[model samples]
Target: MIFSALSPLLRSSALQNLTQQALLRMDAETAHGATISALKLGLAPQQTHTDPPELRIALCGLDLANPVGMAAGFDKNAEVPRPLAQMGFGMVEIGTVTPRPQAGNPRPRSFRIVEAGGVINRMGFNNEGHDAAYARLKGLRVPAALGVNIGANKDSEDFVADYVLGVKRFADLADYLTVNVSSPNTPGLRNLQADEALRRLLNEVLAARAKARVRVPVFLKIAPDLDETALDAIARVVLATDLDGLIVSNTTITRDTVAGMENANQTGGLSGKPLFNLSTQKLAQTRLRVGDLPIIGVGGIHSPQSAVAKFEAGANAIQLYSALVFGGLDLLDRIKRGLAAAVRAQGKTNVSELSGTQVADWAAGKAEL
Candidate 1:
């Protein structure tokens, strides 16, 4: 009611000025921390039954109250999972943590392209070590599904050993685990996305998972920057290894879409609005290649419409990070409502029913619009 009454005024230049002022005063780190804190206090305990059921998704034997999740990088140290899970995320994936702690890239690493409603971050894998992240996860009380994102330290000569070590130490604590071989920020990290490297890494990690008697699902996070050949190769590798699901993408190195923005030149993986189409397209291709395997679609999801688009593109679940930075906690509820409505409108019973439903059209380039 208040929003309706102020609708006209809200569209005015005054409101835009005020909004910019608010954003200008907050950096990404502060914004992310504050938003997680609010979610912890405001939405964590809310009943899921109060929201639409169509928003829920099941992944790796865990029932997520909603398909919406917090992607890797936000809680690099695993400090905010409980708060984030409580805040209303279906799941929270923490870290990109390496075997040992290392300072990420130099400052000015995170840049907000307010004009484009996007962000670019090259904060390497700056994280406290696995032990630190594991300690924090050990104390989390939230009921939401939780996953840990593991990565190789930037300077490690034995990168594969770093990943194996991560699985040995943190896999036991995670409901699931993600091998982050896709982050473009860390030097030589993206190379791990190559078929041979990924195959070797997954083999070792799976062995470690078996050794720990940890039957938890292991998913690989890939880069959206891949071409058809690379993606196809990745699919083959996943199939050969019999690994679990794939997080369709991490972030992209492409800036063709947001080149007009002031900070578009910033180095890092680009995310948010600029990434939506590319990521979804890649997701569609992945779904086609992988057949029935689950894919977590992420990147540029700021609204329920985008979330549904990902669902239509073949994502079993969806994740968000850049959106919260731009839209605030209210965005979660809005996405939930919008996704529920979209699902019902399509006459779908649950989100799972809609996965890969539009792949043919998406692949033909006819459905994206």
Candidate 2:
């Protein structure tokens, strides 16, 4: 009733801040559910101004109003991409949806690390199967570029087949497709990143894409926990294939930065502010290895500065989700403004010009933290 009452009120920054505080006091997953429910009811803030031209970008041939995107986990079932787009995300990715429905890990699986501005969840790609998401996405259009992130089912008989099936299911519907093999909660999923396995997976998935009526760009979403050697192998495999791009770094399992904080020992992937440095470093390393290949950076972005750091670290576009838990939807406007300022300050006409500018420094561990 309170949310319903507030729906007709002007969706202002002050109101959103109050709403965020209220949500934070609830259970993490419960609050997330409420937020999504609110979004579906059209009770969310709308971007009131035009994004400056400097923030415009073309990622893998998909034109975006800005590089900011809602990462996959936020709208796991493709429920509210349009509202998220209205809230100012230049791109919106939905689901790590599987071919079959799954209940995922047990309750209390999502934890908020308040002090560290981070969240940990073993959600295990829980989502309505392909049919549910496809039904929502079929012929649906939104202003922001839409992407579908697909994953293999937990009980999948053949993981590569699952991915191939996903490619066929979404190729015609999405502006892009992301093969997500990085979620830590899914048993043995990260192993797919291994060079040989990755090569096989991409080969099959791409083959499926080639058969689709629409050949949307396909990107691989990898984990941030990999070392330089692993990054090298992945880069080598990706470059040798017809894969369109890469989403640099997903939620991390390591928690070195949030060690003493509450929920620090949670047995799931860590995301939000603490993930920035490691993910960016990995992104830069991937950039160095695969020159000119597009990369969408995700993880640990909470402010405009952090978002800009992603581009400097070699992301052609960037995505965020956990930050919204703390910063509220207003963060999107702030980031777009910050990016526009960054572009003008650097004397660049477009934000894409900033990509990889600091990759060498970041990759070598010389970037300012």
Candidate 1 lDDT by residue in tens digits, 8-29: 1122343333343454576655
lDDT of 1 at 57: 70
Off by over 4 Å in 2: 1-18
Error of 1 at 9 (Å): 22
Residue pairs clashing, model 2? 272-300
lDDT of 2 by residue, 160-234 (tens): 899999999999999999999988898989999999999999999999999999879999999999998998899
TM-score of each model, paired residue for residue: 0.90, 0.95
